[model samples]
Each structure stands twice: as structure tokens, then as C-alpha cells.
Target chain A: MSSTASSTSTQIQLASRPVGWPTPENFRTVTVELPDLAEGEVRVANEFISVDPYMRGRMNDVKSYIPPFALDETMTGGAVGRVIASRAEDLPVGTAVLHQLGWRDIAQAEASAFRQVTEIHGAPLSLHLGILGMTGLTAYVGLTRIAGLRSGETVFISGAAGAVGSAAGQIARLLGAERVIGSAGSAEKVELLTSKYGFDAALNYKDAPVREQLPELALDGVDVFFDNVGGDHLEAALDVMNTGGRLALCGAIASYNAEEPTPGPDNLSALITRSLRMEGFTLGGHFDLADEYAQRMTEWFAAGEIAYDETVVGGIDHAVDAFLGMMQGQNTGKMVVRTA
Target chain B: MSSTASSTSTQIQLASRPVGWPTPENFRTVTVELPDLAEGEVRVANEFISVDPYMRGRMNDVKSYIPPFALDETMTGGAVGRVIASRAEDLPVGTAVLHQLGWRDIAQAEASAFRQVTEIHGAPLSLHLGILGMTGLTAYVGLTRIAGLRSGETVFISGAAGAVGSAAGQIARLLGAERVIGSAGSAEKVELLTSKYGFDAALNYKDAPVREQLPELALDGVDVFFDNVGGDHLEAALDVMNTGGRLALCGAIASYNAEEPTPGPDNLSALITRSLRMEGFTLGGHFDLADEYAQRMTEWFAAGEIAYDETVVGGIDHAVDAFLGMMQGQNTGKMVVRTA
Candidate 1:
């Protein structure tokens, strides 16, 4: 490993802005010698790095909630690692912590910037980047708060097999939803949705048009739609939603990498006729609900009431591959890079 | 005249469902003998009849909040008329009443069906249909309740020269919107938007692309959008919306006549990135707020804080012309047909 013998860190930097769908050429790998830890600073050796769909939006230099990733700089994201060298007493060596200094094998940061996460209770440390982290919290808050999910309401979510969708399906069920339905891209993912994630019905969008297949799955019109995949999925949801339906616009991974502006749903007028409401949200603006989310998700995880899956790509060298693969629907769940 | 010595009422009936933009052939003129009033019924000599954009949706055979007009039957809508004859003791001749029995020179309905309007205090009786009635109520509820309009926020409205839009523009100004911008189809209507309706800036959408013209109009991005015209107008609003912008999806007159499904705004992903919200509403569901809307609008009108306009086409013979003309954007404000 690069960390052996020499005090050096390896990191991936944004080489250039991608014109469309990103490839390996957009990133460059480099090794830099580490400096001695300064007062109040600690050096961390990362264990797992999260790769998410939202990161694709950050690569573009457009104004968004989060600033675009700077060119020639290491990209930042959710990561959990152990402190190897420390000048701060609070973050001592061998302590596991979470920080936003990902895209590198070794992260050096102010101790205050790293949040100590001692134990996730029987789950791997990676849960700090997956189900027990932002991924799980987003699903919980989106359904309960954003969509105003109520007991006995039917909930439909797109991108069911993805990290957020998988968690959302189980969360909806636990929240007393009468029925939970989901859609994924592959037959295996569809099977996994019902067998593992507890989705009452799952659709393989590749087999038929979502609008055609969704109606049968939603015997009565859907009351709430958790929209992770936009485009045709949104159109289908609009078609099948009941009057006064609520849609939580979580993610639009379907058009995240489109080279040009894509066509919107043809049936948005249904929003007016049905008096539906669609509200969009991102995680950063909703950290206030994190504690509640963590408590519930932890209990659910411990009791086996909720299940999570991770698509692990071994090594920091393949982080870009994992990100691209996740974007392409190649990963079944949370796609992460295990740097250690 | 049909209401004179003849004792016959002339009404317009839906002849056939139009394929796209409605034509005169879709309706037929008929004069029928008046039937004797029942125990609780009153005969009204209609004065002013309303022709609204939403009436276009009722012309279709599809189910909606309001049912489709039965084939070969006189279509129903909002109108203000005077009670000419009554079997009920509460309603006397010459009492100005408001009811939903439009599309004719005269009407016969139960006494409970008509709401009596004694006086609008210097405002014309027709104000009950335009500024003091459903049109004005729709604008008030949409901005204050739906969009949650706050002081010092910029407001953008599409179809700003029409009934609800015209009222909405003035209401936004009264609500302490820092700036009010509106879009219209013609230069005349655009001028009236600023000169009469108090819009800070107005765009004649026909002169140039709204997307290109809107950015300069909404300098800091709009906080609230009262969407009366959908399609490209909605797309333009999405392009220039600030974070947490609220969109009140009031109408989609732009697509009301669309022969086929029209593509929605391509930049809907902005809803997620900007944390914007779009909610759809109809007037019927919000009648509980009618008294509040009436009191506020009446006070605003009495104080000259609001202005209203009417585009009148005389005679029941020209009601179809008025309806078609209003749909074609020929009217600048509330399009009403006068039978008296």
C-alpha cells in the first residue's frame, strides 16, 4: 500500500470538467507527501468512501446547494476512517471518525472537522457511510416530513434497489403504509425488491413502460410517490397518483448525466386536475432530523426490521468506477469504495 | 329580445367535443320555453355572464374536478343576474344574485343555489364575478395561502393580463411583494400590466422567448410564481427561480387546447436543486376561505388599492364569440357577456 514506509497520501483530483457522461479521463491520481500534524489537527486513514448520485451534479460548475468540485482538487464526500496520527487529544490514534475529506487514501484535517463515531452496534463501519448515515436519514425524512406520509396510504418509489430507495421502502412499511411499491431497472433488482426490501410489488422498468406496468401494481391510485428517478418515472407517477397526492422529489438520477435538457413529463397537468403537490429536498438542508432518523434506523437495523445492501468496490483506485457504475444502475445498492 | 314578451330563454348547448381549439360548431344556440317555477325555485334574468379559461377544460369529455358538460345540454358556469320571479319568500324580484347558471340569457334555479349580493359598495355588481368573486378569490387564496407570499419577495405571474392573473398582479403588490413581474401575449396587454395592474415589469412573450426575457425581469430570481400559463412559461419560471421558490399551479391555459400531450418544463430538476415547491389547487376545495378573500378584496377595492377590468361582449347571441375570443387572448381582463 502507498501508506507503507513513506508518509505519503494518494488522492483523486478532478482533472477536467466532463462534457457529458463522465469517464476515467475526468480524474487524475497523484501521490503527495504528508506534512506533520499541526496543533488541533489529525491524520486519518480512510476505511470506506461513499459514492452517491448527487456527486454527479457537483462535477458540473453550476450554482447549486453545494459548490461544484474545484478543478485539480481532491473531491470531497462522506467518509469514515481511523485516526493514525494526531496532535489533538480529542481525536486520538486508532479512533474511528467520520468526515467529508474523501477521494483520498489518507485524510488530514482539523480534529473539530472529524466527528467521532465509536460504534454502529454489530454493523460494519461502512454503515456510517450507508444505512446509518445520510443515506438512511434522507429516506426517513423524505417520506415522513417532505411527503407527509400517513398510515394506510399507498407509497410508490422509483429506483427501489438503490441505497435511498431500498431504505425508503422499508421505512414506508414501518411507518404503517398500507402498501409499498417500487421500480428498478433489472429483473434481479425487482426480485430483490420484494424478497429482501419488503416492497409489496416491484417493476423491472426495462420489461415494459412504467406507465403501463404501474397501474396494475397500484390497484388504487398512489397517494405518495418518492421520486428518485425522474423523467418517465415521474410521468408514470403523475398518471397513477390519486387526488391530493404528495410527491417527494428526492433525486432525478434518470437525467443527471443528460448532455442536454431532456423532455419533461407530458402529464404534469395532472398535478392541477388531481391537486397533487411536488416538493424537492436535499440532505444538507435537513440535518436537523438526523438524530431521530439515526435512532429509529438503529433500532430497526438491530431488530432486523430493516435490511440494507452495499455494492463494495475494493480500493480507492476504483472509486471512479464505482461512481460511474452506480450512475449506470450497475450497483444494486449503496456503492462504496473500501480504501483500506 | 329572448327575455322580452316571448317567455322563451336562449341558451348555448355543447354540440360536440372539439378536437383541439374549440370552434362555434361545438356549441349550438337554442331558445326554449320557460317552465313554471317549483316551490323553492327562482327565475333569474341574467345580467353579466362569465367566460373563463377553466371553462375550456369542462368542454372535454374527460373527468375532472368539475364534470364534463353532458352532450347536447346547456353548459353551466358562474354568472351574476337579478331575480326576476320567485316562488321562495326570501328572494324577491330585482334582487341581484350570484349563481352558477351561466351560458344563457336567463336562468331558473332553487333559491339556495343563488347567493344574494346586496351591494359591493361603489363597485359594480359584476365585481361579484370578477374582483369580488371566484376570480379574485382564486388569486387571493393562491398567493397568500398557497404560495405563502411574504413581504419583499419578488413575484412572477404568467397570463398576467387575464382575469386571475390581473387580480393576482394587484394582490401581489398589495401583499408587499418587492417586485411584481408579469408575462402577456401582446404589447397592449403587456403595457396594461404595468400601467394598470401595477406590475413592476411586463414581458410580451410573443415578442421574444420568455426564457430569454425573464432573467432580466427577475434580476435576483423570483420567490413566488403564480402560473396561469403552463408549457414554456413554466419552463421560464423554473429557469429564474431562487432557492425555496413556491409555485402555485393555478392554470395551464397554454396547454388547455393542446391536441396532444405537451412536454413539461425540462428544467424541473431545478425543483430538487433549488428546493422549490409546486402545488396544484382548484377553487372549489378552498371555499372555506371565501369570506376572508371577499372582505380583504372588498377593502382593497374600496380603498383604490386594487383595480379591475372587464372585457364585455353584448348579447347572448355573442356569448360563444366571447368565449372563443377570451380563449384566443382577445380580452385583457375578466371576459363577461352581458345579456342586459
Candidate 2:
């Protein structure tokens, strides 16, 4: 139904694996000639591309739930766009889709690799990359399924102003948590946690040790700890967790780029003494809950019971920058590169 | 009900709280006058007394699941014996009973605190302290209910020569595990794991780092990790765990007496990438499964599908020595002091 005559594409490639923290030199931008579409292939001009903390772990040449980002190849992640060219009958031109062909403005892949998204009447298309996408689903699955969050329970979240953490704070409140406490890196983020994200109490970890501050913030003790930043935050949460508490470990952003093995929480023995349960999970294994999350998330958004933030960095040229910024805690919520 | 003419009883009392490792001087043995049985009380002459790892935690003056032992008070633990003098109508003088008033020759407690144990036609009374008791039930609950052990799954256990660990090796086999590997502190204990307990492979953790030995022992990677010794053994299990692996943390005897905080596993980040689960539980939280565990364990014993051992230290005077020795890994299966 629609077509665009584009013969060239610009993409970011992982030139070499970084030693510790990745630098701009570790990535390279390249221009490549586009080829004609084959049968069952669709060409998409991406509207929004996600840059998440998990990508930092994939930058290393180590095996994980998802494979490492190969050298000299365009990095892949969640992206949403309109199908500008289609050789398949089922996914015709002008179809809105979501696919894993990010780090570039234009993507040509088999139609089956992309899934068509039904537009939310008034929501932005980029919401699929943040609140209604992997980030929001990760926060939901970790709280309801992994931690089994109950009403009248206290919850503590690390990286509380970031994408998944921000959503986790709100979701825990809606799920009937009696008190929600959060930890962030700066005073501004701490204020936003209570004023914007509805956290009962928020602390700036950089101001003091989390172990000493957590007990004071969580007056009654935390029943669920949704961990995003691991190292010290995890250790602190373990110290103040209530008996039979649950920890939903979504990310260890604190140690993702460390050069050497980081020491784990010293208070892990608390798990035994308190009979706690700590479960680590990735979003891919829990796709079965996506529809349920979307339905509930959509309803909450409609009723103004949910809110999300995005730090949009303009252009595909800045995709690597956006990723690096997200890893460095430069974003308040989801960091997405607007490539169109 | 016949009553003994003896008016004196001897017992061990905690003299001073230990800082790092406990010593003989920390306990004292003294004689106390025995009082006549009250309306609802009974006098039990213990046949066997248990000295377990969990007792080390209770010795410290800190809050835990169980209250700490008070200064100058007699220590308490599991014991099996015959009721000597009973004033309660529910319990007869000659009834076999299991109670929590050990570390002494004679224990006088309310009849409700002691439960009657129907004598197994041919089993020794000591089996109530090892395989058919708390130790055996711990292994069953951790493997079956907590770890959710499945058939054809490789299982690894740390401190696999101790009471709970020894029973865990056999229980994993009976539960249809594909491979069962274990680690102990010495060669003799390691040998017992394979020869007597039917472990597929056993390692002496003292000879080499568990992290180096686990990969070779568990070539296919481990699905369930029954943690009895925490520190290094837990770290090693985290390294080679299969995706979606389950770790049932039963005890952390390795760091039970540490004066300073111990560093936990450095590779805990493996939890996130592998989508692993680590849950800590105590036997008290799982008493509901006692009957089920006893029935299955008894059946296994009858079929000759299970084997167990006990390191008995004779006489009540040696009760403190037995407990100290057990804490140092001196005993094999169950460490019991026979007072009769």
C-alpha cells in the first residue's frame, strides 16, 4: 500500500568488545547498500529503538540467556516501526510492527521475524518499547509472579527512577503494597521517586550506605525487594528483609561493566536465617504473561493509575550513546533513540 | 508409673558466648537436684542425643528463627528415649518418646512437649535422630518441595557426608535424579559418599577448590543444588548451574562461627543470566510434610534402597565434646551421644 525508494542504510556495529566500561571507540558507524527484498521479507523504517541496561552484559563475549552481540554486526534490540515495503501478503505495506532489528533506521527481515502491533488509540508508538514492552513486563512479572507481592506488604526497589524500577514502584503500589520504598543515585531522582512515582519513601544511595539507610526508610521491613542495581543494594536489602521475604532479581546493573568478578551480598546468610526466597529472571522466558500484563497495564494507563517517562535521544547515530548513557544512570526512565 | 530413686541429674551449660570458634571452656558440666514430676510433666532418660549444625547459630546472642541459648542455662536439642516417670494420663511410663531437651542424661518436660514415636519393629531408636527424623526430613523437603527435583536432573550437594547431606544424596537417587554428586571436607567422608551413599561422584573440598572440581564432577551441569555448606560450595554451584537451575539452601555450616561478615558467592550474577532460583528454608516452616517424608523414607529403608551412619560419642560427660567434634566435621552421618 505504501513504498519508499531507499537504497542505503546507516547502522551502528560493535567493532570490538570492551575490556570494562565500553567507550565510543568500541563501536563504529557504517553505511551499507540495501538489497532487494526476497519473498516473505518486509522493510521497516524504525520509529523508536530501545537502549537498556541488559545490553551492557551482551556487549561482552560471554554466553547468557541471549547471545553476545557479535563483532562487526549491527546490534539487535526492540524496535517499533511501520512496514514501508512488503513482499508478503499477510503483512502488507503500512502495517505497524515490532521486531528485533534495532541499532539502525531501516530494517529488512523475514515477515515472521516481526509481529504486528494493534495501535493503542491515543498512546505513542514508542510506549511499546518502554511501559508496554519488555521494560514494563519485566517489572510486572518480577513483582506478581516471582516475588508474589501481597497486599499489606512493604516493597523496596533499587534503581527506582529507572525504566523497570520506576514501573515496579507504581505496579507494587497498585498491587496493594502497604509501603513502597525506593533507592536512587541522586537527590533529584529521590524527589521524583516520591513526587512522581509515588514511592512512600526514597533515599539517595550516594548520600549514605544503603544498609544503614534502608532500615530507617523501610520502617516495618521489606517483604519484596525488586533488585535492579545489585552489589550494595542487594546486600542492603538482605539485611532488612522481613522473614519469608522475596527478592525478584531482574538486573545487576551495578556490576554489569565491572572488570573483575564483584563480591556478592555478604548478608546472603540472611536468606537462611529469615527463610527468604530470591529468584533471578529474564523477560524472554516469561512471554506467556505479556498479554495479561498489557491488558492490565493498558487499563491502568487509561485510568491514570500508571505513568512512565522516556529520555529520547534523536537519531540512529546516537543509539550507542543512548545505550551508554542508560548504563551510566543518565536516564530517569527508558532511554530510546528516535531513528526516523 | 514407676519412678527412679535418683535425686541428682548432670547437664551441660553454656558458660560464655564464643567469638569465632567454640572451645571446651565455653561449656561447663554440673550436677543439679532433680525435682518430682509436676501434674503434666514426665521424666525421660535419653537413649540418644543429637548434636547438630543449627545449634551453633543458637549459641550466639542474636535474634534468629529460634531464640539464642541464655547464659548458664542447659542447652536444648533433639533426643529420643523412654518415659521414666509420668504424671500425665496421656503418656505411660514405658512409652518411647522423642523430645527437644537433650544435652543431658535426664530431661523433665511437660508431656505435651514430647511426642510418642511408634517403635519400628526392627529399627534402632537412633534412627529417629538421623534418617527418620529432622535431618532426613530436611533433605526430603529441600529436594522435593523447595528445589522441586525432577527425574533425570543432575543434583549436586555440598557437605554431602554429614547427616542431612548423606540423606540428601540417597534421596536424590530415590527421586530419580540422573546424577548425584557431593563434596565433603576429607577423603574418608568423600569415599563414604560414593560407596555407602551411592553418590555418582564425590570430592574432598579440602584438597581442591570446589569451583575447580564441580565442573568435572557434573559434566552435564547441575539442576538442583542442596546447600549444606555455604561459602565456597555455594559459589561453585552458581558457576556451573544449568539454566533454570534451582538451589535449595538448607544450611550454611561453613560460616556458622565467623566473627566477621563472610563474602558470598562472587558469581551470583549467573542467577540473572541463567534465570536461576535460590530459596532458603528451615525445617520448622515445613513440618506439614513430616508424615509424607517419614512414610517414603521408611519405605526406602525397608527396600534396602537407603543407607545411613552415625558417629556415637558415649556418656553424658562427653556430650559437649560430641557437639564440638560434630561442628568440626569429625563425624560422618549423624553425630549422637548415647547416654544409656
Candidate 3:
């Protein structure tokens, strides 16, 4: 826990932009020399670093909601760490902090670049990267703000075993959604969704076509859909949505690796015929909901009303592997790498 | 003017449902003898019966926003008529009325079935089917209520020469849209969109692929998209949309006659990456805005702020011809038949 100058930081840098699916060849591990902390600067030793699906979109050279990750730069994303060296009073040494300068074991930046964080209800530090951080906020905002999931409504969530989807299912239930439906890739995850996540029903898309299975499960018709996997999931949701349904387009992990642009849902006419609404959003402007979300989430965490799962990998060297695994649907929930 | 009954009404009824594009063989005309008007009912002499793109969707037996047209029934839609005789005091003789009892020379129904209307600023009764009735109200609701178009935002309208699209372009301009772009199928209609409809830019989709052309015209990216033609038009709009853009899904004339479900947009990932919103709506729940729309449209018409074109066929005998012609992109704005 030395807060000294002249230390070295290990980081994973982008070597080349992948045309379709990313591989280890796309990233290169490098070490950077650190200098003495300047005025208002802080040095953090990361405890855990997050790997998310949206990062796959950023890895491409194309412009998006977030700028593309520049070639030959250290990857950045959500991370939780402890301030080991600080020249600023706000982030004193030993205070836990969260930031975007990730895919590294050490981050040294101005104090303003880091946000102070603390563990809730004795949860692990990785919890900040999962249920208590952007992952949780995404689920909350998609349900309440984007899709406006009302009480007594049924919610259908695609990619239900992943970070955002898993959290969305529990949040929808806690928010008074009468029925929560989820779709996953594996039988184990399908069982977990119903047994552990309070989902009313779950679909293993690998079993039967979602087009056939969804209509059977959603007898009342989905009133709200939190979609993380687009394509066929969107088409199926369009087929069975109730009149005036709402869809929150959070991700399209299904098409992230498709080299060619994938076709969208074929039944979009359902929009006009059923009066459906589909909106896509990022967490940028909705940071104002953080205070409300944190407050409620803190209580829920204490009452044991919220549950989450994480696929953890050891060492910063495996960060890219974790990301690739998550993208391949190998991870059941939030995928994070322990950097310390 | 004869106020007495005992006349016969010429009616067109559905003989068979079209599998794709409708042809005359699917319809049959019948002459029905009229008895004296029953209590609470009125006898209306049809003045003009309207033909619209949406009628094609109703021709299918599949359930939609509006119930599918039943077999062997008169094709009901927008019709304006004069009350020739009435047992209901509210709809006395000489009253001009608009009702959905179309495809006929006369309609006899309860007084409540008709909405009393008059010409605006001495405009012809055809205005009721074009810019002052459901057509105009659709543009108003799509721009204001559904898309939530803002002042100074740019708007792009597909099918800009048709009734709803033509009306949307003018209404967007009046609502303070900084730039308005339109797309039509023919060179003549494209020229008319900018020259007569006040669109800042217009594209002939037939000249080039919309995906290639739209990005050039919508250089700043579209903020509000009022879509009447789906498929390639929707795919193009998805490509050039700005951050936080809104799309109102009004109609999909492009695929209404398709024998099979057509593939949707190929780049729906834009929905998430750009933080865009796409909504589908019908006028059923939004007719409450009709009074507000009527007031504003009447003023625009009176002040010469509205311009419209109609392709009127001679008799109800060509009603099917007019509808087929409109579907073939022949009509500039409203298409109607003089039933009387």
C-alpha cells in the first residue's frame, strides 16, 4: 500500500480495432511509469475492474453514444480501487474510490476524476461494479424512466442472466411488476432466473425458438420489455406485446459480433398496430437519478430484497478474457476481474 | 331538394380478401333499397368517399390496431355527406356530416355516427379528408404528441407527397422546425414537396437508395422523423439520426401489400448507440387532439398557410381504381371519389 512516486502501473492497451469479434490479438499488455503526485492528483490501486457489453461497441472505430476507444490507448471503464497516494484532501490515502480509468492495476489522476465509494452491508468491493454501481443504475432507469414499467404490468427481459438483465428482473419485481419473464442462453441460467431471481418464468432460448416460446409464456402479453439482446428477442417481443407496450433498448449483444449489419425485427408494424414505444438510452444524463437509486438500493441491500451474481476472474491480465467471455454469453451475470 | 326517402344506394362490398395487392376482383357492387329513416337515424347522401393507404391494412383478416374488415361488408372509411332526410332532430336535412360509412352512394345510421362539419375558409369538402380531418390530425399528433418535436429541431418526413406526409411537412414547419426534409417516390412529387409543401429539402427515393441519399440531405442528422413509408425509409432514418432523436411510426405503406413479412431495418443498433426513440401510434386514442388540430388547421387554411393536392376520380365505380392508383404512388395528397 505504498503511496510513493516512481512506481509502475500495468495496463491493457488497444492494439488494433477488431472488424467483428475481438480477440487477445486486439489488445496488448504494457507497463507505464508513474511520477510523483501533482497538486490535486491522486493515485489509486484498483481492487476490481468491470467488463461490460457496451465496451464492445466502443472498441469499434465507428462513432456511437460513446466515442470509440482510440487505438494504442489504455482501455477505460468502471473500476473500484483504494487511494494509496493523494495530494488532494477529498480523496485522502486509504479511501475507496471508483472511476473510469480501468483495465489497469493502478490509476493516477486528478482527485476530481475519482468518486468516493464504500461497501454496503458488508458486500465485497466487486459489488460496486455489479449491483451497487452503473449496472444497478442501468436496470433501475430502464425500468422506471425509459420503459416506465408500471405496477401490475408484465415485464419481459432479454439476456436475463447477464449484468443488466439479471439486475433488471429483480428491480422490476421490487418495483411492483406483477409478472417478470426472462430469456437466457443455457438451461442452468434458465433455472437460476426463476429459482433465484424471482422471475415468474424463464425461457432457455436454446430450447425452442423465442418466437414460439415467448407467446406461450406471455399469455397476458408483455406490457414492458427491457431488451439487452436485440434481433430475434425484439421480433418476438413485438409479436406478443400488449397494446401501448414500451421497450427499453439497452443493448444488442446478439449482434455485437456480427461482421455485417444485422437485420432488425421484422414485425415493426406492430409498433403502429399496437402503439408500442422503444427507446435507447445511456447513463450519461440520468446521473441525477443516482442519489435516489443509491438510497433505495441501500435499503434494499440491507433488507436483502436485492440479489446479484458475478463471474469473477483473478488478475488484471485476464480482463480481456473476461470481456470476451461475457460477450460470448459465458458469464451468468456481471463479469469482473480482480486487479489486486 | 327532395327530403323524402325511397331512393336506392349503390354500395361496394368485399367479395374476397386480397392475399397481397388488391385487385377489382376482390370487390362486388350491390344496390340496396332504402326504407323510411328509423327513429334516431338519418339518411345521408354521400358527397365524396375517401381512399387511403390504411384501408389496405384493414383488408387483411389479421387483428391490428383497428379490427380487420369483415368479409362481404361495405368498405367503410372517411366519407362526407349531406343529410337528405332525417328522423333524428340533431341531423336535420341539409346538414353536412362526416362519417366512416364510406364506399357507398348513401349511408343511413344513427345521428351519433356522423360528425357535423363545414368547409374551411371556403375550401372544398375534400379538405375534410386531406388537411382538416384525420390526415391533418395524424400529422399533428405524430409531430407533437408522439415524436415530441422541438422548435429549431430538424424533421424528416417519408412519403411526403401523400396525405399524412404532406400535412406533416407543413405542420413541422409551422411548429418552428429549423429544417424539414421530405422523401417521395417520384421526381414530380419530390419537386412538389419542397416547392409546395415548404420542405427545405426533398429526396426522390427512386433516384438512389435512401440509405445513401438521406445522410447527404440530413447532414445535421434528423431530430424528428415522421415515417409513413417503412422498410428502406426507416432504415435510412435510423442511419442519420442525431443523439436523442425521436421517430414516429405512422404507416408502413412500403410493406402493406407484401405477401410475406418483410425484413426490418438492418441497423437498429443505432437505437441504442445514438440514444434514439421510435414510437408507433394510431389516431384512435389520440382523437382527443382533433378539436385542437381543427382549430389550428382552420386558421392555417384561412391564412393560406396550408397547401394540398387531391386526385379526384369521377364516380364510385372507380373507387377501387383510385385506391389502387394511390397505392401505386399516383396520388399527390388525398385521393377521393365523388360518390353522388
TM-score of chain A of each: 0.97, 0.97, 0.98
> What tens-digit string does per-residue lDDT give for candidate 1 at A92-135?
88899999997999998789989999585678898888778889
> In every candidate, how many clashes are there?
0, 0, 0
Select the stronger candidate by DockQ from 1 and 2.
2
* Model 3 lDDT per residue over A1-340, tens place: 2435337899999999998899899999999898878899999999999999999888888888779998899999999999898889888888989899989999999999999986665798888888999999999999999998899999999999999999999999999999999999999999999999999999999998899999999999999999999989999999999999999999889999899987788899999999999999889869999999999899889999877889999999999899999998999889999987
lDDT, residue A332, model 2 = 90
State in Å the error of residue B295, model 2. 1.3
Q: How close is candidate 3 to the true structure, as a TM-score?
A: 0.98
- lDDT (Cα, 0-100) at B204 in candidate 1: 94
Q: Quick one: ranking by DockQ, best first?
A: 3, 2, 1
lDDT string for model 2 (B198-249, tens) is: 9999999999899999999888899999999899999999999999999999
Better model by lDDT: candidate 1 vs candidate 2? 2
How would you encode candidate 2's per-residue C-alpha lDDT over A180-227 as one tens digit per residue?
999999999999999999999999999999998999988788999999
Interface RMSD for candidates 1 onward, in order: 0.6, 0.6, 0.7
lDDT of 1 by residue, B1-340 (tens): 1234225789999999988999999999999988877788888888999998888999898978888888899978888988888787888877899998878888987899898995866777777889888999999989988899999999999999999999999999998999999999999999999998899999999999999999998889999999999999999999999999999999999899999999999999999999999999998789999988877877787788887789989998899999999998999899999988
Misplaced by over 4 Å in model 3 are A1-6, B1-6
**Clash list (residue pairs), candidate 2:** none
Model 1 stretches astray by more than 4 angstroms? A1-6, B1-6
All candidates' TM-scores?
0.98, 0.98, 0.98
